[model samples]
Target: MNKKLSYNVAIVGATGAVGKQIIRLLEERDFPIQQLKLLASKRSKGTIVEFKGKDLVVEEATPESFEGVDIALFSAGGKTSRSLAKIAVAKGAIVIDNTNAFRMDEDVPLIVPEVNMEEAKNHKGVISNPNCSTIQMVTALKPLYDRYGIERIIVSTYQAVSGAGNQAINELIVQTKQILDGKEVTKEILPVSSLPKKHQIAFNAIPQIDVFEDNGFTLEEMKMVRETKKIFGDPSIQVTATCVRLPIIYGHSESVYVELKEEYDLKEVRELLMNAPGVVVIDDPANQEYPLATDSAGKLDVFVGRLRRDLDHPRALNMWIVSDNLLKGAAWNAVQIAEHLIRNDYNESK
Candidate 1:
């Protein structure tokens, strides 16, 4: 454990949006890699992806694909992770899954490195990355939660179209041009692509993300609610969310309101966030300074601003949070976990 070691790494869904970002970060971060494997579905086989100025051909992902991989990063989708994560773990690879497949599993540690790095040490073969929205929210809230106990949370998200994948980004561009040219817009994706109804994402906001459940909450909203409790290891904390998809293309923004168990001073709350790791505060409202999605795009840190106490509630405070959904939300968060494991020589079987 003392000597520097390079790992044989594999990335599942290497051709997708988040997967591509993961590759870029691994190279940019200069992660120790003895060998790298690019994996995708059968349709993406034989595709070429560039890494370290060399072309790496992507292969179809099978159980055997992970035979010698020391770390497997899964970002394809929940279905792919559900089927392949166990196989990767069986082959002695530590699986850091970005999909929701195992986030709620009791044995799987849902990790946001800045929030709860200790939970990762107890993983029994698999660790999960939180949802893009949840990751940024929790990252901003952790300092406050530790200082003043949180009683309840209510959040509304202004998420980017990129969260839906590369296809949704294309749809937004195509639809926008069509509208400008006075041509009929074609809608094939957005809100929910698989569902019968499709909404225009060009200059519009859709109130739904993922499919709606019996409780009138979309799957995405429920993920924020459930994942927050698990990440904090505090089931008593009440959380609610309304996730919305916006026309932007990179960062996800949230308006978060939290009721603290203890009274807090506004100045001290801002000071607490200013010193927190992985959080950047920009709350100078008079100068028109605040965290914007445009400013946070491609950035690794979660941006927090517009800090204030709620007028109607004595113990409640409000803030705005933003981060790159593709980076900190998905790829960067996953890479952070891998780095932590290697740094600590984490035992997957523990």
Candidate 2:
């Protein structure tokens, strides 16, 4: 590939799905990359990935791969990040990690740049991309939270199988086609891959995501709880979550119930969301205009609608939110952090 700019860019796990999307987005956004290093595991070494109409060979990622690199986007899963993210940062390359490995780390800032980019400025070598479901919710909630003052959030997620990775999405499709033809559908990946039980994810809603904790909340649920506080910078903001995995392949949807610190006019909520960054509010219930996973698929903005005051909880509002699980949820958010770093020069305290 022809060189373009001064920053040496590295994409760890470049052969994987989100890794590839990061590369595609960089090119599509015309990020000025001087050197593009595509790195994956040893098994994926020599795999050819297309970038900017050029074919590039994927290399095995090592600490050495990050030498002289300015930005390294990691999407290789938590273990890979746990092992290599520190090394990349040690070599002076900023690591925008798309994994849960360091998300809960006190030093690592879990970020949704549109919501709290200030956290990005104080990176201790690694900056975490929030859970995809959290990204869309927080982005949509920020405007309201600022204007109306949010007190609590209760969320039920309708997440895609793709959030579990490509294999899970493939299994859902295969099982659907097989069952339609009177064949058996096997379950092995949904809920949790390491768990003893796996459920059929085709045309079914599994109420568990990730492993359950001591409190019976799944890791995904815990992510929503903790990451919401971290992103909102308000630990007092009550957040309860039930995360579910659905058969959809590309998008994630959330049915969110939020109570405001002040009584909010529902129309005002719609207007604020309509103008929020990375958010699109569609609240026309008469014509049935609302957010849907199929419609939100492949889109960048978080689509939010079904806005109304909660019937029983007078101070609360209920709404639906959706976005492409891969783009906005993982790869795109990582890319946005990189863009923010470039824009702000990584100085938040200033």
Candidate 3:
């Protein structure tokens, strides 16, 4: 019960891919920490993992697991996060959830630090990390939104299989090998494991991500649309998306078209994004270069390219955005919230 912190942090779902990456980022960034805790499900309880030249045993996550922690990072899944986040927050631990648990909660600030760092200070003990696709989109849009004022956004996502999970990553690899060997590809998990119909993602792309809702939009697409408005704090910014699971791994790429409320020259647009923090513009079509998933992998910055204005509508512009889905999309973003807390002199009480 002695949570009198010198930065006692607990990582929920510490055995998962994103959790592992968060641990690495915390260590690599040399985040101020006096104690490090790893918590997973009961099934993964005894697993040992490396962290900053130390071996840490993964404990089963439960309500009591967060008792003495100052900050808790949750990414197990929505169900697990929903069940434990309140418990973590109740115990005086500020929670940064990477799952979609409290994203739509009015009290929680769904944040992307580079776009909105001030929101991090207003936490109700829980801050939601925006969707991977949404994160990159807003990072690319912030400069334009603040300078020219965004009116609308239409995004189509080319997401990697790793966004599904480690099993899905392995599935793509196994299925790809089978295809290359002239063998039949298997299909068990591509677009939601719990759903009735599974699609082959080996050489094909599935246009759906999460299950469909009453409005006919898939949850993943809806997240991109809804979370964009929340992160930008602008309900008037219209957004629609088509989320697809492709054969790639690591980066999530987007083809985003936006119409500004105030018209601006393409040269000014390029200059603004180039000067924006955490965004790299790679827009030189004649040189045969642009943001690609293969090149964006293992990096933290969001890449923007293929920028051009719509010929018919001077207020409209199009561009391509890419970011490591696991890094800036998930782990890095969560770590950034924690960094914001420390830098802003926020206490455990929020």
Candidate 4:
């Protein structure tokens, strides 16, 4: 868009789980990159990461790091993004933030490329990626929303351990081993790390993800409720979610119930999802085919299955959706927004 052959890219939080995936995707997708810079916290400084067969040292991110950057992909925590995202934008870089810090901000566009990419065109230098669970749900529902008009949405998520980062992944493995060895299982990082209490995520399901608000819904649940309306640009659509943490290591799966405004034929609904972009329908029940976290791990597409009509509510439908929490949910979605900007020549007039 700048009339250059390629752009200079920077990945903040380059040493973390989602950040590492962003690096891999950028390379695997062969994104046009003139220069790739890796930035992380002081603790991660001097760490070496590879890109395109070359080693790149992770640097301590500071205000000066944005100097020559053209596109900055931020997977750092919300606090870091709150502190640095604007500075990067002021330095003439488009920021695709994979954090909750700016998603609901009136000026910042909340984007899931397959769903509401047009909102991204109005970005005032920074665009926000939705929560991991929200991304995959909206992607699979977009086609149906367009055809049948979604009236109400109720979702329950079985999220992976990796959504909490590498530390939580380690905790799950440690606890699993300890329990098997008859040692006291350690509990430290599940549910919420900052809280005084922690729970074992191995061989168990924690009915909470993120802290709960006064309304009794967890932060993760509220994100799906709020972000879905914004992405669909429909406030009248009712949405509620119950997010749960599971022992799985990679994919996040959801059991979703949707009430539509108009009646829908089951065959047409399946056909619509089959034709949707970034969606894979695996609803063959006769052969025991369906979306599974084990099958969806490492994949970029959102896998959907178990589609059926609700018995009591004739206009209602139910289904299951799955995707790699780190890939399609975070890194890949952020990267797709960047690619969309390039393909559409966004901000070229400037």
List clashing residue pairs in candidate 1. Answer: none
For 3-110, candidate 3 gives per-residue lDDT tens digits of 333689999989887998999999999998888999999999999999888899999998889877888999999999999999998998889999998999998989
Q: List residue ranges in candidate 4 displaced over 4 A.
A: 348-350
- RMSDs, each prediction? 1.4, 2.4, 1.8, 1.0
Q: Which structure among the candidates has the greatest TM-score?
A: 4
Residue 223 error, candidate 1, Å:
0.4
Q: Any idea what lDDT model 3 has?
A: 0.90
The residue pairs found clashing in candidate 3 are none
Q: Which whole-number lDDT from 0 to 100 does residue 326 have in model 3?
A: 93
Candidate 3 TM-score, true structure as reference: 0.97
Q: How does each model score on lDDT?
A: 0.93, 0.87, 0.90, 0.93
For model 2, what is the error of residue 97's alpha carbon versus the real structure, in angstroms, after optimal superposition? 0.7
lDDT score, candidate 1: 0.93
lDDT for model 2, please. 0.87
Model 1 ranges off by over 4 Å: 1-4
- Residue 129 lDDT, candidate 2, scale 0-100: 93
* Per-prediction tally of clashes: 0, 0, 0, 0
Which residue segments of model 3 deviate by more than 4 Å?
1-5, 347-349
